[model samples]
Target: MSRLLDMKEFGEAAPFLRKSDLEILAAQTVAFDDKPTKNIVGAWILITDPLCAGKKRAWIPDEKDAYIEVEIREIDGDKVIVETKDGKTYSGLFCVTVNPYKWLPVYTAPVVAAYKGKRRSEAPPHIYSIADNAYNDMLRNRENQSMLITGESGAGKTVNTKRVIQYFAIVAALGEASSKKGGPATKTGGTLEDQIIEANPAMEAFGNAKTLRNDNSSRFPLKQNQSERRRGKRLLPSRQCHSYTREALMIIQWNIRAFNTVKNWPWMKLFFKIKPLLRSAATEKELAALKEEFLKLKEALEKSEAKRKELEEKQVSLIQEKNDLSLQLQAAATEKTCRLYEDQMNESKAKVEELQRQLSDTNTQRARAQAESAELGRKLEERESLVSQLQRTKNSLSQNIEELKKQLDEETKAAMMAEELKKEQDTSAHLERMKKNMEQTIKDLQMRLDEAEQIALKGGKKQIQKLESRVRDLENELESEQKKSNEFQKGVRKYERRIKELTYQTEEDRKNMARLQELIDKLQAKVKTYKRQAEEAEEQANTNLTKYKKIQHELDDAEERADIAESQVNKLRTRTRDPGSKASPKACS
Candidate 1:
């Protein structure tokens, strides 16, 4: 089975718009449908045939988006004239064109029948041939197939790529599952959405992998222009069937006007011009049929209008009835609320009276409590006075006890001082006896201390301290000298390393300079040779130009002389023909 769809129709024509002349004539005539709003103020319109009432309508722009999508409405519009040329619409994407293009006559339902199930060799050379070859090869070989298209900018590469995609989608479709090894395929069936979702990861992976150098391989949008146009339900509002009838008389007048205008449309002219006789008799038949249909539509429209008017009147009456019922309901509610409030007020009044009685009882109880509290306060005052008297007696007793303690402490201290004085008298007598004994021993000790060894021992401590200070000063000086020597060693090593680095750098610089000088000498020699050659070439060119000019001038003179001789010959011939004429010598010369 084969189904052929026109790329022309898919890209350019609406579902019902392939024959634009008649269909658009119907469009212009049916109605000037309006659904006005004040959302910064805009409206929409609907137009359809008998059963297709709300199903077909035109989008009147309501906002910047004009209702739904972004202004991407402008993409193919700008390329229509150029792209439409040569029956190739979408290939214009890859090429610069002067006119915007949409669809063409190729890849239509009729043409598709020729290629369906046909081998590559069976069909003429075409993009379909290439795609069909790939498909056949894959099925025949049981392996993958590829169609590689490579081209420079403006070479229709992208356009051909898109065609391949559409060809695969329509031809060897993967919508059904094929069993493998007698088991169910992993994926049996998927929706378009699911397939798209599955493809997203691949697109993301490939797009991200592409580099700046390969911009053409990145960011594939896979957009369907057909989807954008087809998925709309006539651009009508969600709640369709507004049920308002357009004037039948107005519609008839509009159709009469439409008949004239449709003839002028490019497609209409093409249709008539291309058709044999326009099949003229068919035109008459269609016109007659259209007139009959219009009459019937007009009559039906009138009947519907009358019925709609009647319905509108009934709707108005119903709305009024609803308002009246609502008013009655509101009045009943208000009455119920008033009755409830009155009952609450009566209950509140009873509560207030009972509360007043309770308040009086509480007042009597408060008065009884006040009398009992006063009696207790008088008892408390008496008890406080008795407590103050007891406190004063305790204070006097504590003062008497403190005085007795002070007197006892003073008497004990006086007794301790007398005992201490007696012990001191005994110690003084013993110390006086010991002093006489020490005086005898001192004379003996003085004789021993006068010896030289004892004097030397006493002086040795100062002499030893002076020597130690000298040793410490010499050690510090020695340490300072050692550190200076180490520092000099480090400086010497660093200086040697720096000298070696400088020497190496100087050698490298000398080598580089030598190389540079050699390069300069060669460049100078080449310059001298080129200069000599240039001078020689210039001399040769000048000589050749002079020779060419001299030759051209000589040739110009030769041509002039030859023209004069030829004219003289022609004159002699003319004279010979007119033998009767006398020939003057000047004319002969």
Candidate 2:
């Protein structure tokens, strides 16, 4: 309660809370205290009641007098559920409730803390978990990351912002300590974590102002700029501490201008006085560090200058030694050495003349060899042509053999078909004879029936009955013969089908034979042309072979002359090398 009052007072001095608003709040508190006594209501009753708990209720607004229904669906460790009259719903670990007496803001701080550093899906929905996720992302990526916290006035942006900054400071300090691992501790006089934590109070004091909606609303916005170095992974604030003072100055200037319209603000005067001291201190520290670096560079420069002088002396000695050696070489050059060189030159000229003669003979040999190779190449081409022609002949012969085999197969197939036709014709002839014999038997029975009828008229009724019985017997025999005749007809149809199939097969065979005959004729023509080409190629090969042999002989003779010239050149070289030898140039000649 005391902390709350202090915050209220601070808001007033910081010009964030208006005097009229404070007065109105005070009057409302007093009126509430003086009102008639009513039964004390516990929040637990609303949570546990069957009708109200986990159910929606409509209530009239104090300011607008309009009724709105709000439902409280659930309350769990992870989240609370609330729904409005329009079917809109919200779920989170924190919730705000309005009562007849006051507005209550409920927080599930412990539940949110339990899920810190967990993924958004793993953790329950909460703002703290979002901050934790952003921090983890920054650590994992080693790159710039930003989180934007935006809301209307009085939405607790400032409070959440402070919490996030505090979290980073604590985490960074702990991480730095763990990384040291018993190494020497780093000085943290003005580390980024310390500066950020220190800047929070100053930022609120100058930038916050009063609004109708929020008592302590930020008039000037806060921006978090995150960046990373191109060559290193250091965060922006770590390398940009100098820029913080400039931002602070701007905030101070803004506060001064805002309060200038009003009179007598002691905090504003205090801020004006401290701004210069902060800037000067930062400037002095930077100057001192620069001076120390400048002195170190100067000492390094002097050391390099001395080393350069020592190297210059060594270079002078090397130049002088080179000059002395040149003079010694000049003194060693004498008349005898000159005369010896002249003699060597004359000997080299003689050797060169002998080498030229040898080269001329080698050229002649090379020309003959080339001519011989050309003649051999021509013979090879002729031989290849003959070989190709023979290969064509072999292919033609193979084709002819294939055609002959096909013809033989066709002949064999035709002979088999002819034997089958002869058997079928014999069966057909026997069937025709049986048919004629049946017809003749039928005619004889008809004649015998006519005679029986005449006899019946001459003799008694007994004879007529006997004659009718015989006629019935004869009719049965005729039916049996007709059945046999039908069977023969079916056999004749089967034979006719077989003959039709054989005729179609014979036609196909004839076409195949015709095609084979044409192929055989074409192959025979090719064979004849190939034989002619082979004979011509063989004759050309023989002619080229004789010419090659003649060129080979000439090449061998020219090579022998080249070898003789080479031996003479070798003797001249040995004489020049041995100065003590009795052999002189004139003597060799």
Over 1-589, each residue of candidate 2 has an lDDT whose tens digit, in order, gives 1212222212212222223457757877784333322121322112222344443543323234364445565754333344444432433224221222332221223333333445655533445555566666656765444455556655666555665554444444444453456532223346764555444442332232112113322523342233344323433443354366557657777888887755368877788788888998999999999999999999999999999899999989988998998766754553345555555556555555655556565566556656655666665566656556766765776576667557656755775586578557757765775577568657755765676567757875776677688779868877986796687668667756765675676667567667756765665565566556656555555554444454445445545544554554465456545753664775888
Taking the tens digit of each residue's C-alpha lDDT, what string does model 1 give over 56-129? 22233334455431111112221211111112133311222221245554455444434445664454445655
The number of the candidate with the highest lDDT is 2
lDDT for 553 (candidate 1) = 58
Assess every candidate by TM-score. Answer: 0.21, 0.21
Pairs that collide in candidate 1 are: 4-109, 6-108, 79-100, 79-101, 80-100, 80-101, 81-100, 82-99, 82-100, 84-101
Off by over 4 Å in 2: 1-332, 409-419, 438-589
**Count of residue pairs whose backbone atoms collide, per candidate:** 10, 2
What does the lDDT come to for candidate 2? 0.53
Candidate 1 runs further than 4 Å off: 1-304, 311-338, 361-398, 414-589
Q: Ten residues in a row with the worst lDDT in model 1?
A: 77-86
